[model samples]
Target chain A: MTAAPAAVEARDLSKEFDGRTVVDRITFAVPRGTTFGLLGANGAGKTTTILMLLGLLRPDRGEAQVLGHDMERDRFRALQRANFSSPYVSLPHRLTARQNLTVYGRLYGVSEVRRRIEDIARELRIEDLLDRPVGKMSAGQKTRVGIGKVLLNDPEVLFLDEPTASLSPESAAWLRSFLGAYRDRTRATIVLASHNMPEVEAMCDSVAFLQQGRLLEQGAPRDLIRRHGKQTLEEVFLEVAEGDTGRQQGPGDLA
Target chain B: MKASLGRIGAMMTRYMYLYQVSPIRILELVYWPTFNMLIWGFMQEYLRSATHPAVFAASYLIAAVLLWDVLFRSQLGLTLGFVEEMWARNLGHLAVSPLRPLEFVGALIATSLIRTLVAVGGAGFLATLFFGFNALELGFGLALFFLNLVIMGWGVGLAVCAILLRYGLAAEALAWGALFVLQPLCGVFYPVSVLPDWLEPVARALPATHVFEGMRTVVQDGRLDIDLLAQAFLLNIPYALAGLAAFLGAYAVARRRGLLMGTGE
Candidate 1:
């Protein structure tokens, strides 16, 4: 019998803008129900890579597939079972969280949308903020609402670009725990892109460090630390950034 | 692929929710159309006494102004739906959803229909009250004129959205100014024959020109010009289809360029 397909796969994916390569021929596969991190500094092509996987951006070469559907041609099929969220993107400011949630729920074709919104609001601990306009909410509240939006459909594959990039530490920690619990409960495959090493180490099953639009290295956090003789993923990130030895490391073991 | 009406309705519902919160937004929709109607109505009254009264009927100017608002308001409504998504920075979220680009365009068109009716309906009611000129009296001619103008408006509105998608927020001024550039060419206030010899061909090529010319025939000749109405619709087939193609092309380019990821004002 054939092995089960990876929940997410990128085969030699690449992109460029204005003569500058943003994501060079990178390849990876994320197993079902696992949390994978794309750790990178700013301008390291983390967001661009996620966008291509979400089919919000087209790769200049190669393929991105989610749930065995080609992202470029069959994205709608994957999108039906997927959702994306980022603090950098926003909901309508004039709309209350409930209103915003209801709209997206309907867009995703959720049954009993009002009930789903209440359930998500309760899960995200956003019940009190439901009637408040998104613009009136603090950053933490908005991030919760954003997460609530993602969870509305109970997506099988979730793409999050810097999920807690702008939150305070306390809020970030709370969100990390919330997501960890969410993954445990739903068994959803999550692709998280962030530069925060601790967050990546805490939440990810495996991670790949990207530098200057290229994949520097990818492995289990602890294994990467052990392999590079480093104490933390942060130190490993620095070493990988300075060295050019990861061109051979691929997602072979993960796939 | 088959489009989902439920998704389209959901997008429309989002805009309707916006109106529910902002009374100012609702009021702005009707304010301009009504204001234009009243001003032109009073001017027609003045022209009745000052100029050759028999040269143009009393209802001619009032009807022209009312009909013209349908096109302007409809185009504004469609573009406003798009611009609102940009301002909210919600396009990125929308792009990743199960929503298709054409389905989103369908929502914009449907929302514009609702908006155009509210604005032009309110203004037309006022036209009947203030000028004692009932637009409804034009009968089937009114439907013909309304249909052709709205189609042309949607055609132009879609092209504007294409430009906005490709060029970013800097080109937003086209939303308001694009249709106005067509007004003088469409002969909203005068006959296309009154245009200079070199410009008449350009005027005649526009779908709105046939619509306004058709309106003038109803008002001045006291008869609906079926031939002109047919010509307007035939012209709209290409104009509207071209706009749809342009919008889809721009959406593809935006996807390739990753513009949809961060499009905002």
Candidate 2:
């Protein structure tokens, strides 16, 4: 049987800052049309890995490719097919949401920009907030608008960094559902970096656990839990994050 | 190329939206230029009666004020354009998009040109209304001088942006102060020869020095000094190229060091 195509691939991807390694020689592959979660604690090189994949930060050693394009040599081509959304970053505050969306839509070279914006606005249920300045919007409203902005390109791959970081549980659940539906409809690959264990388990098809710039364990949530002899993914996460690897069992090694 | 243009227009539209939404932003653009023009106009009126200069004193000072603003506004426009993205925490968003670094630079230059035009245009009008002096009298020479000064400003501004990118917000003060450091050396209101002998060569190396000298020549001799204009362009080419190199170099360092993230205050 043929293997699935990789939507994103990194080989010995590494980076260091000020003589300190922030991203060790990490390697991973995310298949197309799947949601792959990058689970890690704070300062675990999650954002750094995402930036390298997006070509915003170059890897000090090794290489990455997104949608078959080399990130370093042909980043623009890959970027054209990819979009990123994060609640931490913001759109320009002085401009209205509509104006902000229009600018990003135009930047992505979207045809019929206004119509596309209206369609996304409807889909995201952010029509009322469209004309309001971004600075005045509630956190939930801004998160929705940010999602709308990323969707303007109809990107083939989406990178999300702590997308639900500041969101309430209800809003976070809604966003997760929306992302799942969007992924199914578009068959777009998604790379999600998050600390929410439940959200990652519910939304991600596969997960990679990172600790201190290294990939400690990676597999489906159930597979990881079973291999660790843990009852839940959260416990598995803690076990892996806390260097309890002696308790970890390989696949099919479960007693 | 077409995509580049679209992206550039998109950036310009972003700033256009900012200017449209806030009257204060638009007012800030014109305020300093107009105020400086008025003060210089009054000073010129006094100099006109007190000095027995061959050229009309009002003509010289008004031209100085108007052209000097062309330089200042161009530099500030480019610096502030980058700063605005930093303020909004939008640099990360922009970097991950399909926008190339070259396209980003193009947009900044295009925005700076538009800003320089508006600010200087407003001040030029005020100069005419208040002092009855027409800066356009410099004729076609005005375009060459303006182009030279704007290029020089871009060179300086790009360097300042490079410093900011490498060092983050702590180096932001250089954006406002760097250009002024060149002001006295550029001989904006005087001649290069008027400077100290040791400083004369340093002054001559600056393209704006030749521009202001060319302006003075046009005001006094009523003829364009093609030699000065040629010298200004020659100096500008290398300076602008160096600025571009510095910015690109700094960007590489920033990316390698993971400095691009969380750059905003």
- Which ranges in model 1 have alpha carbons more than 4 Å from their true place? A245-255, B1-3
All models, RMSD in angstroms = 3.9, 3.3
Candidate 1 falls in which docking quality class?
Answer: medium
Give a tens-digit lDDT track for model 2, residues A1-255: 999779999889998888888889999999999999999889888988999999999999999999999999999999988999888888888899999999999999999999999999999889999999999998878888999998999999999988888778888898899999999999999999988898999999999988778888899998998899988888999977766444444445654
Candidate 2: docking tier: medium
Which parts of model 2 are misplaced by more than 4 Å? A244-255, B53-58
Over all chains combined, what TM-score does candidate 1 have?
Answer: 0.96
How far does residue A32 in candidate 1 sit from its true spot (Å)? 0.5
Q: Give the TM-scores of the predictions, in the order they appear.
A: 0.96, 0.96
Global lDDT for candidate 1?
0.91
Q: Using DockQ as the measure, which candidate wins? A: 2
Q: Residue-wise lDDT of candidate 2 within B11-113, one digit each (tens)?
A: 9999888878987898989999999999988988877787775445437778888999999999989988988887888888998988888888899999999
Model 1: per-residue lDDT, tens digit, B25-48? 988999889889999999998888
Candidate 1 chain A weakest lDDT stretch, 10 residues: A245-254
